[model samples]
Target chain A: EIVEAIAGALGEGPLKGRRILVTSGPTHEPIDPVRYIANRSSGAQGTAIGAALAALGAEVIFVTGPADVPPPEGVQVVRVESAREMEAAVQAALPVDAGVFAAAVADWRVAQASDRKLKKTREGLPVFELAENPDILAGVSQMGEGRPGLVVGFAAETDDVIPHATAKRARKGCDWIVANDVSPATGIMGGTENAVVLITGEGAESWPRMGKADVARALAARIAAELETS
Target chain B: EIVEAIAGALGEGPLKGRRILVTSGPTHEPIDPVRYIANRSSGAQGTAIGAALAALGAEVIFVTGPADVPPPEGVQVVRVESAREMEAAVQAALPVDAGVFAAAVADWRVAQASDRKLKKTREGLPVFELAENPDILAGVSQMGEGRPGLVVGFAAETDDVIPHATAKRARKGCDWIVANDVSPATGIMGGTENAVVLITGEGAESWPRMGKADVARALAARIAAELETS
Candidate 1:
């Protein structure tokens, strides 16, 4: 009874009953048995977000592609390789309070992923017939009933970040869009620091450059506050 | 002088005065400022090989892509992202006694990689014009007078391992081809264990399943012996 009183005073750190889903890393679209098409996402920011959310007492389900960094310790990690697998994993981890789609999902995959190694030939360049990958963010955001209350998607752009992110937020039907420039000059693609703009229905707010962990903590706090109000 | 004599007695592991170059990981070919094409190579085997050669007193120049595993200690690490960068790095590390091409270099790159982010829309699928990438292994093997004394390449095959590897060895003009089956059933791709077949001018010799480190040690020993005789 005394412990319960202290717990009540602590107030569960704001998100004790919340369940969050986060997708991280670069999805590999198979070209052949041994070859794949991927992106340059390291999953650093997403993993940090998962950690931050867990720290706030949210039960986080992390659906991750093959990432350079290991998944956060506290989150339930669902490892996947390709965009299709990641989509499946994300769908399976649904019915959460919030969803953060941070994964750099490949836009396309080989129409028929080769079952064997593709041999180099003297003929000419090989033409890869590609098929579009499913838009997981849109799917989750537009869910009829199981949609998360808060849906966040990422737009990694190099030019006109704000405008593009705003458009992406509307197109993906997500509640918020975190946009960041990953130009070579910015060194944000695989770097530790991030400079991002948070876009919502209200407006756009740009944050100064900070460590990935800091951005993640801020985002987690914002989510907590929003959930509290809702 | 006495310590030098003792070292001589211990044989210096046969690669004492040799310089070796190794390539590892999956090269990322950019599609846009933020998107790229890559593979699933973790560079575990290549890193282990670098470590093994270093342990044998060989000067190892380790050229790598954005790999999951950190480069091994006691070696010169050259970090790169795309196949072109990797090829340039390999060329810069020339005049080595041996060259090991183990990287899963992207076979093609976007003909004109966009300078900005590519927008997604309701219009249609975006078409990417891809150009063939330089065959690093074949180029190094057929380097004529500037080529290393011993050149090795890798053939990650799923079916018909021996025939395909032998053909690859002949086609690439490499002295040896280390072939492995990366079929999903094998659980070798990105896994800690490996089962490889060494194809030389003599014949093919398949090794049993073992840890990647053990495979590296065995390969290093074979390289040492070949260098010693040559």
Candidate 2:
């Protein structure tokens, strides 16, 4: 561990002298004191990406949510719960060489989260109103001056994978969008294997089904090349 | 493991020939194909209880939701996800000597969970409607015949602990109610230590703060005594 940290500090691999930010896992939006809304993101892919980046000698900053898989070693980890918290954490980790937005952040949260536990009462079901969360990817991608050299976003869709991811890339103004079909049949959402489409300005490139770590290594290599070229 | 199972099968302890049903963990109510509502139930207490009962030679049938803690050894484990499935599992495990209702089951679920991932559209946030879940404890307690010899329910309250728990005991028609404060201030919800109140027909008895496993053993001992006396 000490040797790895020394290597990272001294700048040692393909991504030497580079700094990258990777957000992994699922942001939980609180409903009240006890309950919350969550998505099934185990953070396996994001953790793998962080490790891969670190293996390539990049100084990695891992901003994570409450993930089942723990964060990788040799990276700065910043943990957050809600989307707002995650956005704040991302803002704090600025001016990196590249940014990878992999966290499945909740799009909405309970508008008025009660201070106490919401009781099941004679008043019937409570009114549940949602407020839109801040768009972390779009905000960073569109930033004028302090934006990273390459901003990458992720899209987990159930249908029309290529079309949705392509639209998302254009809409979010991101350099690349790593899209995957997380349909129940595919079992990719919480599974170890992923078949992803890399959407860029040129076009969508589909990768064959592979382990999450392999995909992470491939993505990390691309990121290193992109940073070196730019 | 084999020896323990053999002991349970051969009726080697105080709770010999006894059948106990225990439900643990938090039931997740789906919001969509990707999102779900969850609570901070680690299932520590219930898992401990199952172990304790099995130690006393009881044939333990453990019905559990998605718990952070895995089910203990030497018990029949029935894994469930939602409140409705838990209720059905409980019904199927009837005619037991005692029943421990420890799961933090969701009181309500989305009226119509979407098949596809909910998209953030221009129309604004989706209208979220909820439907009350089946009262599992109350239903089991009010059974005319084939009801367990002793029915136990649990109450997690923030304020007015005794009153809420007492009222719950009456409402659910359970023989005992284990009540605890789950306010964020008290780390008992997901923590190993617990300070709980045992409410019964006689009165409310407050137990000193202790490890969840200790509490389970004491409760299991009491259950053995109660069954023996009857």
Candidate 3:
């Protein structure tokens, strides 16, 4: 393991010269001074993927939201909270060999997010007007001049996983989509194990249920192989 | 410290035979299976307060949300997620001598929280219809019978701290209100040190800035004195 680590550090792996951008964790959209909207993505899978890619000697720029687990070792980590911040951070690390959109960014943000705490009035509950957040993956994937070689997006669905993921892959204009069922019964949102369907241009490929680290390794290997061919 | 621990275990302190309840952390109100609303309360202050109460020989019931800090030792712990769940757990641990409502419970929850994740469509953003959560503090404070000897409430305000907390205490019919400024600039929302204003029947008493543990010890001692006299 130590020798492998040294080899990775010395740029000896297949992906030695490749630069990869990985966005991980759940973005928190501020509602008020004290409260915010958040997702249950713990960034476990994304963190593992970053580690795996780094192990393969990729120059990894990890733009992450507020994740439960700490960022992995031997990677450049950029922390962000809101989806807007994550988008900005990702844009800054642009023109990479591959872009992995793993962070579960909030689809919308409170349009009138209060600077001060909102007081409960005698009338009724406060109304939240939401504005759509920017689609970071689509923005980068459709970039004509400075697009990455490969753009991978993640789909965390609760129903009709394969169809939903396949549709997402088409809509996002990404090379591949790693989709997983995050239903409460599945225990995969924050759990270590992952059962994912990898959707590509050819078709949807279902991978066996395995640990997040193993899934990351398999995905990283696939990415490396694809990059090697192209 | 060893002697204190032994003495507390033996119920040899001022709060011997007294049962106290402490609610700590921020309640998560789910928007969907994967999305939720959260605050910055780490439960550091409440954890310290529970420990201090336990050390003083009180039978402490620690009701906690998903806090960054774990519950203190020597207390019966109850874990919960949403405000409604926290309210239920707190109700189950009632009829105590004193109740410290320290948890940053959400005042409102999405009325139409869906089991399935809401998807974006041509219709645009989803409207979040909110319903007011049960006011646990007020429910306990204004109880005609079986009311605790003392019901203390906490106010985390971004502006007009004293006035806001004072109004909150009066509205909730609580005996005391511990108010603190949680503005981002203060760095007190999730930080270790706290500068609080204690409001009683008389008036507000501002305490000098101090560590959360010290603040907890002071508050716990005050509660002990109040319970002793009552």
Candidate 4:
């Protein structure tokens, strides 16, 4: 009781009783022991969100892929490797007030990963088969038993950020789409900073670029406020 | 020539000829020598965007306020403290292909900051005077000379994310707006992950929550793809 009082005194924690599920980082699609397909994601954003949510007093379940960054404190973290693993983890953590799909899951994965590292042959580079991964956000949004009240997805595009994001939202059937231009020049991959657009079925809102931590805090606060009304 | 060959061998850089401008972090409004008004911002999203843009081969100029995280590599980074300083820095680095306003500029600043640390007596608390700060994103978007081709803004809201974001886009006179809930309970303020909605004059797109780095990469890639066609 004393601890709770101290916490309440420190900040006006709005999320006193809420469950939030978040995912982060990149999933590696392995071709062999030495080679894999993956994106440059540091998981900084997801970890920060988890921390921010905890600070606001919500019970957080953070599902993450292999990331170079550490997970935030005060949150229950479930670590996974592949998209399949992440999806399962998310499903297990569901029936929450809100769900945020933050991981950079690979669109395609190797059909079969060799147990041993493959070496270059005299003929040429080896060919490998690929398969599409399940859209975790879509699956969660459409879940029959444990669907979250709010489901959000990420639309990382190279061109036509808004248009593509809009299309993705419809196709994926998610409630919100956070769009960004991820040209290599932006240095967003594997970096700490970010700039983004938040789009919903109703319209769009843009924010000035700022630190991920600040963004997370602002987002957490907004979620708490909305949850209160909803 | 050899160096060029090696670089080409690595990959076909998409943003080689492009220019990008990104703003990041929270602006501090000073109250006294020992106090200032600021928000919770780490500048992760903005820095990640700047890095992502640079990775795609665009020359990126990053203007940021104080941040807890480090800026991305291979980009020109200009650090500032207050909103006024951030605005000046952004203005000096204009005429880019794209502009992303991700900084959380203080809506108000101390009208008069005491030169020395405020001394407290046996009396009550001290009162502060505040004034509005310049809207850097709107300023750059409306700049007559050396204006960026595309202007993006971010709207952080605790309620009516879509409506507020849409209004912000129109009021700010920017091409796009990213809206997200930033209520304290969501853990979005100081966290690493983000979930946002993209708002534009046409419509809105919802996205899943993801790492800030992935969001940055996606945004950068989309920007590159657009530039390629445009």
Ten consecutive residues with minimal summed lDDT in candidate 2 chain A? A1-10
Candidate 4 clashes: the total is: 121
Better of 1 and 4 by lDDT: 1
C-alpha RMSD over true interface residues, model 4? 27.2
Tens-digit lDDT track of model 2 for B1-230: 45644665577777999999999999999988889998779999999999888987998999999998999988999999999999999999888999999999999899999899999999999987999999999998998889899999999998899999999999999999999999889898889998999999999999999999889888988999999998
Ordered from best to worst DockQ, the candidate numbers read 3, 2, 1, 4
lDDT string for model 3 (B1-230, tens) is 46766777888788889999999999999999989988778999999989888988999999999998889999999999998999899889988999999999998999989999989999888999999999999999999888999999999998899999999999999999999999999999889999999999999999999999889989988998999889
B150: Cα error in model 4, Å:
0.5
Which candidate has the highest DockQ of all? 3
Q: What is candidate 3's CAPRI-style docking category based on DockQ? A: high
Chain A only, candidate 1, TM-score: 0.94
- Superior by TM-score: candidate 2 or candidate 3: 3
Measured with C-alpha atoms, the lDDT of residue B11 in candidate 4 is 34
Backbone clashes, candidate 2: 0
- For residues B1-230, write the lDDT of model 1, one tens digit per residue: 24532443343656787899999998888888767777768899999888788777788899999887899877899999889999999999999999999888888888999887776656866778889898899999998788999999998888999999999899889999999999889999989999999999999999999999999989998998999889
What is the two-chain DockQ of model 1?
Answer: 0.65
> How much lDDT does each candidate structure score?
0.88, 0.92, 0.93, 0.75
Kindly list the per-residue Cα lDDT of model 4 for residues A8-63, writing each as its tens digit.
33543677778899898878666553335555467888787777877888888999
* Clash-forming residue pairs, model 3: none
| TM-score top scorer | 3
- Please give the distance, in angstroms, between residue B200's alpha carbon in candidate 3 and its true position after superposition: 0.8
Query: How much is the lDDT of residue A74 in candidate 2?
Result: 84
Instruction: Report how large a share of the reference interface contacts model 3 reproduces.
Output: 0.93
Quantify how close model 4 is to the true structure by its C-alpha RMSD in Å: 23.6
